[model samples]
Target: MLEIHQFPCLSDNYGYLLHDPDSGETACIDTPDAAAYLHAAQEREWQITQIWNTHWHPDHAGGNEAIKAATGCTVLAPEIDAERIPAVDRIVKHGETVWLGEWDAAVIGVGGHTNGHVAYHLPDAEMAFVGDALFALGCGRMFEGTAPQFWTSLTRLKALPPATMLYCAHEYTASNARFALHADPDNAELQTYAEEIRHRRDAGQPTVPSKLLRELKTNPFLRADNPELQARWGHPGDAVATFAALRAAKDTF
Candidate 1:
């Protein structure tokens, strides 16, 4: 079976280490802090064999070279952003597959946060290491992609199995929940989910690894296509426009 070790790093960033016990192969989901990742792997007695980068942001790929030098692990990055990332042993594009031990992770192009961002989906595990493309009750800022492009990217994620567990890269749920309530105030589901998030944060617990179904019902960004949201946001029948408006509002919220 595959195991995941999630730890906090770089303030709010959540670092992930994907380990396959049978093969003793471990992959760092992203290199936010090399030391933290290395230490986590060492504590688990797992050998680092691969580094899978979802995007080229400094916070996401900043520790690639150090980690690779220390462990001799091959680095896999998005084809479109390989030049921006360090020590990339391979550049993978959308629809490509990468492996760890006997498990295969499909590369999904989810480029709204960044033009080249990708998500790793392990079907058998029913989980995805989504980097910053998505967050609980929210998503990444539209940094490099357009509203239409971002909407399309989100659509792909929405089509995933409803039970798929999303391992997003940040501990931004509490803040995201605040903005979600502001954006979709009448959404009872969101109201309840926000309350739950509040309790989770107060308890010093992680609010990541959010299930897709709950997000679909509560996340305003993911519900841009919903008739109520589209009408309320004044972009009836236009999911992209609704998404753009919601994103713009969140930026300043």
Candidate 2:
């Protein structure tokens, strides 16, 4: 069985520690803070054997060198961003598979938030470690990619099984809920989910590891193809145009 440990790091970032008991291999996905990851691993008596980075953003790969120095762990990241992530030991590309003990994780190219952003999808575990690409109720802002490119990336994630659990890097659900309501105001599921998100945040709980099915029902960014949202945003029938309009609105919103 694969055991995942979740903890807060660097303000809103959430760190993940994936442990495979069968082989005693553990991997840290996206190092937001090396000290936090080290402490968490020490508390669990699990040594970090590898690091799977999803992007080259400072918040995502900031702890790479520190963590690698401490654990002598192997670091794997997208080859396209190799120059940005100096600590990467193995360069991975899209459609490649990496093994964590006996479990396999498919590396999916999801370039939107960053030019080389990727997602590590463990189909067998029904989980995905998406960095700043896709979020719980929102998607990442296009920093280095275009709206159409981001839309493509989002569609790829939407293709995953509805039951798949997504682990995003930041704690942006509370704010995302607000935007979702604006874009999908008439969606009953979104209204309910927004309330739930508010309740969770008010109680100081993390609204992460959200189910993909729930996202499909509530996330406006993921529902760019919905005619209602398109009409509400006045983008008519073009999904890409609707996505760009929403994203532009979100840039200032």
Ten contiguous residues with the weakest lDDT in model 1: 126-135
In candidate 1, stretches whose alpha carbon ends up further than 4 angstroms from where it belongs are: none
Please give the TM-score that candidate 1 achieves against the real structure: 0.99
Which candidate number would show the highest TM-score if scored against the true structure? 1
Listed per candidate, the RMSD to the true structure in angstroms reads: 0.6, 0.8
Global CA lDDT computed for model 1: 0.95
Model 2 per-residue lDDT at 171: 98
C-alpha-based local distance difference test score of model 2: 0.92
- Candidate 2 segments whose C-alpha is farther than 4 A from its true place: none
Tens digits of per-residue lDDT, candidate 1, 49-95, equal 99999999988999999999999999999998899999999999999
